[model samples]
Target chain A: MIPNNISKLIDAIINKTEAKKAIWGKTSRNEEFKLFLEKGAVTTDTWVENGIEAIDFAIYNSYGDKIDNFVAYKGDDDFDILSRLHNTAKREFFKVDETIENLFKELNDPKSVGKRQIEDDTPLPF
Target chain B: MKKTISISIIGVVGIILCIYFFEDSDKTLPNYATVIGTICSIVGLSIAYINILALKEESIIISKQIHLTLEKVNQLNSLSEISKAIKVNQEIQEFLRNEKIELARLRTLDLKYMLLHFNNDLLLNELTSDEEYKKLILDFGIDLNSLNETLINSKRKVDFTKVVKNLEELSTYLTKFELKLKSIKI
Candidate 1:
């Protein structure tokens, strides 16, 4: 069965992609990547959401595609696939060690991080 | 994985109780008379109140865990986005360099051997040499040094991966936490 969190992740990807036009403005490159990723052999939901094609491809290949991409895009096989996987195992962690360090800077900056206001209906994975 | 499953179980129980309480508020009770009925009523009310309290606690716990997880996921997503943006631009550069290299390789060959070399598949050492073909092979070797750089910066930016791990740790710390978040009773 699809785990609820995983299901929610998948849903969020689709929903976000559907709304990207309003979030990030138009880009021809984004459209090009979108087309390649939509049909590519990989888990493309997130890439489709973020309007980033190569990421979609990388993610697809990383999860386990034959990975017949180019020399350029393939992740550095630092210590073979296992090492890479292990290294990436904690790739998503955000420790936030210095919450106070940059709050003032962020407040002053015009280009603040645009926090994605996740939908109220979207169930979070804990 | 284990922690999440537990929270889900607990959450399901709480939800079921809520639903039942709402739906059967005035349902008929099995007959018991006088003092016995009164005693049972008091006990039952206390039990109900305790259950309500439990449900509320579970709900609060589930909410906190969910928020933590979401925050982490968002952080990781943002870092990945930045990494990807760098990669996309880097790939374009690699594509250009690959084209230059291929052109130089072909240029060095005598015109007489041009078609022959083309047929020999040296230009296509990877694939056929066309504008389209070049685009396909020219990945910008961004993984070499770029990914490390991304990881470092993204770490500073708060990689969501840590949050995912932390959530997994906390949720699994107790069976109750998992049961509640996961909505799985057992």
Candidate 2:
């Protein structure tokens, strides 16, 4: 589970972004947060299914600005540091699992990961 | 003080009345005793509730201190990392390679310091021994790890040579991020 404080922080950041004129529904930070909110604290979950991909989403999203905004690390040595990061990618993967599981139980109708669907059907035009 | 005294007196008097005069007559004595018992119970519960409220206030104070500590640590680390990353040029990759040993050494020392702080602030605290504390620390470590990787991946995927004909391109954006990280405090 995301620490309530961290969750609040992410919400605050999103709120800060929301006040601005952005074309996105949820800011990148909010999207990263929606990853780890699971039904329970621990157990069989989504991380076990797609570990690397889950963490990659969070990392890339969180670093989107730094990655694109700065080019200092756009080199071989930088790649070395990033490769080291993937080794710990399991954390984000677990977050994804937890988030999906949370939504499942939150709706009070557990379903296979593939069968889960969000209520918002409309896509953002932007 | 008046409430306390009244509750106490009401409680004791009811106890005394119930003891001798009211004991033999269960009907009268028990009735009087119930009134005293209720008053004493209410007063006791009120005092205990007040104590709990005080404790909650104290905990909020402690959590604030911890937050301040975390902010200080993050700020120092963020700006230093920004400075380290920002100052380097197209030749930074090769230059950093030469100083890789020192960089790794610094990282090791920093990790040791972090571990020490975590042990003191988290492991030594009452909650430090708790499972939740352990999980929190572990998750924090994992998050930091992933952050390192994201930085690497983003830089690796991009073609630097295309933009690195001069230092101006890299320096322009690096300074912007440096300002962003150092928005107010250096």
The DockQ leader among the candidates is: 2
Each candidate's DockQ: 0.01, 0.02
Per-residue lDDT tens digits for candidate 1, residues B36-140, read 355546555656666678789999999999987875665454334334433433333343345332332222222113222332432123323333322221111
For candidate 2 chain B, which ten residues in a row score worst on lDDT?
A: B156-165
Name the 10 consecutive residues with the lowest summed lDDT in model 1 chain A.
A25-34
Please list all clashing residue pairs in model 2, or write none if there are none.
A38-A98, A38-A102, A39-A102
Segments in model 1 whose C-alpha atoms lie over 4 Å from true places: A1-126, B1-33, B97-186
Cα lDDT tens digits, model 1, A24-54, are 1111121112112322221211112123222
**TM-score for each candidate, following the candidate numbering:** 0.22, 0.29
Across B55-154, the per-residue lDDT of candidate 2 in tens digits comes to 8999999999898887767756655654554443423434334534234334533442443343454212443344443433333333333234335543
Evaluated at residue A30, the lDDT of candidate 1 is: 17
The C-alpha interface RMSD of every prediction is: 13.4, 13.0
